[model samples]
Target: MAGGSNTNNYGGDLSEVVRQLAVVAQQLARSSINNGDAQGKLFKKVAQSTPPTYQGELDPTILQNWLREFEKLFGAVGCLENSKVGCTTYYLKGEADLWWQQNEATIRALPGFNWTKFQDKVRDKFYPSFLLKQKAEEFSNLKMEEMSVTKYYTKFIELSRFAKESIAIEKAKARKFESGLTIDLQLKLCGQVFETLDEVYGRAAHLYALELKK
Candidate 1:
């Protein structure tokens, strides 16, 4: 987010998107003490309550890509700890769309992929351009099925939009079905977050990129 040449020339939403992302990562780290508390009960309830927030096989390759980019991006801050947390495919690639975003541009830019290494090697070439350079997964892939290799990677950033939003919708539905662990728990949790995390996701630039247009 600093000024000058390295200042995310993609402009507007991109830098803001990255900044908010950094804040999110930082906040989660800062609030881990309470975050763990919030998680312990909520997760158990969410899992057993009703509709599950998570479903389907998250792409391992994409998660690795996210972890690497996370390391590269947040590494500047020196806050990201426990390589296991960042390295795990589970958190990083919770949904398919998130994985797509971590490697969307490069996958689209190249004519074809080295399928064998496609999942792992993506970590090597990540850059700002990967997220900013526009590409669509729908048109990039040649296969008829929507999830085919070529098409799958193309729509990552755009799909990232979906992946992020899906969590809110799903979580809300879960809360409604599960009662959100009673009112007291909810308020206490909110209080913890208000005191801990830097910013809420919706207010984060990544959620409002269109409004921040340069």
Candidate 2:
């Protein structure tokens, strides 16, 4: 009788363990399906929105802002190659679609329209190769005398996009920004440690504003 009771108890424990594992597996499967469906729905919504138009030239600041919004939407929706098809569908219908229609020749030349690569092509088209050297030179020779602190800082950020290779590191960007400031401002900022280009800009701008008030 004792041996029989022990066998029964062991069987009950084994059944409980199996039941728990089955529940966990079912939950995991449902979660995966739900996540995929959610992403698909998001992608569809973005595919139906107004698409951005690219003229021969894009305002660097506005282009960057638009790209950021697009990246967020794309990332939320799994950023798949099929998303490129949806992008084309969304873009090819509006007046803004003129850009897509015009650029179709370039688009067809790509091996395949991967969403990320498609975005890169658009960026290259609007950013332009000739502006690269000009932007770098502008950033390198930025002067506090030519523009207000805010304007100079804004231009610095816009130009940095073109010279990303040179200012790829945060420290390099900070140093480059400081180099463009007047000698007095640079001297004032010399002892301060800054973590980002923006922080340097803010500090320099504050000092310039004080000087203006004085």
Candidate 3:
């Protein structure tokens, strides 16, 4: 009777251990399925957006535009921060693809690697100093002579990237933009205390419309 009681106790303990193992397995399986489902949804959204492929163009404007498009797509789809570099790099083709394949290990090994870091790497490779300086000069010489206020504003925003320090502050940005407007618009907008670039643009546009009517 004592031997039988000992055997029964051992069997019960074994059974409990098996049950706990089964529960852990089931939990792991469910977690894996949830992760897979999330990845599938993200891929489907990215496909629908038809993200552009990059083929190692050296043009700063082209590179900038490609980066801009991806940024927009990432925002629109609610892309995970950890996944942005993977998604953007997957679109690289030809020379760009080869370049990434070579440097990927090193880039990935860097501390705290992310989308911004990836962007910096790409710019470092493609955006040469001469091209950057040329872009800055273009921004410095920008004027609203022939272009409408809307068009001038668009170009101003686009070229401002190359000359960031010139308009680093909101007041400076407003002043830089105001100075670029046509002489007539400048004369009209001279004594105002505009706090933001948008405010200056709005006032200039309104005045421009009035001048057109006259």
- The numbered model that scores best in lDDT is 3
Where is model 2 poorest over a 10-residue stretch in terms of lDDT?
Answer: 87-96
* Candidate 3, superposed: residue stretches over 4 Å from native: 1-23
Tell me the tens digit of each residue's lDDT in model 2 across 1-214.
9999999999999999999999999999999999789767765777666546434344555556666666776666556656554554354334335666787677767886566676676667566666667777777777767678788788788778778888889988988888888888989988898878889988999999999998
Q: Which residue pairs clash in candidate 3?
A: none
lDDT of each: 0.38, 0.73, 0.91
Q: Report how far residue 110 has shifted in candidate 1, in Å.
A: 2.6
**Model 1 spans with C-alpha error above 4 angstroms:** 1-162, 167-181, 187-214
lDDT of 1 by residue, 1-214 (tens): 3565455566766978999999999988889967676555443433342321212233333434444554454344443233223222233234444655675566646654433234344333332234322322322321223232223224332344323433345443233212223333334335333221122222222323443363
Best by TM-score: 3
Q: What is the TM-score of each predicted model, taking all chains together?
A: 0.17, 0.59, 0.80
Whose TM-score is higher: candidate 1's or candidate 2's? 2
lDDT of 3: 0.91
What is the descending TM-score order? 3, 2, 1
Error of 3 at 209 (Å): 2.6
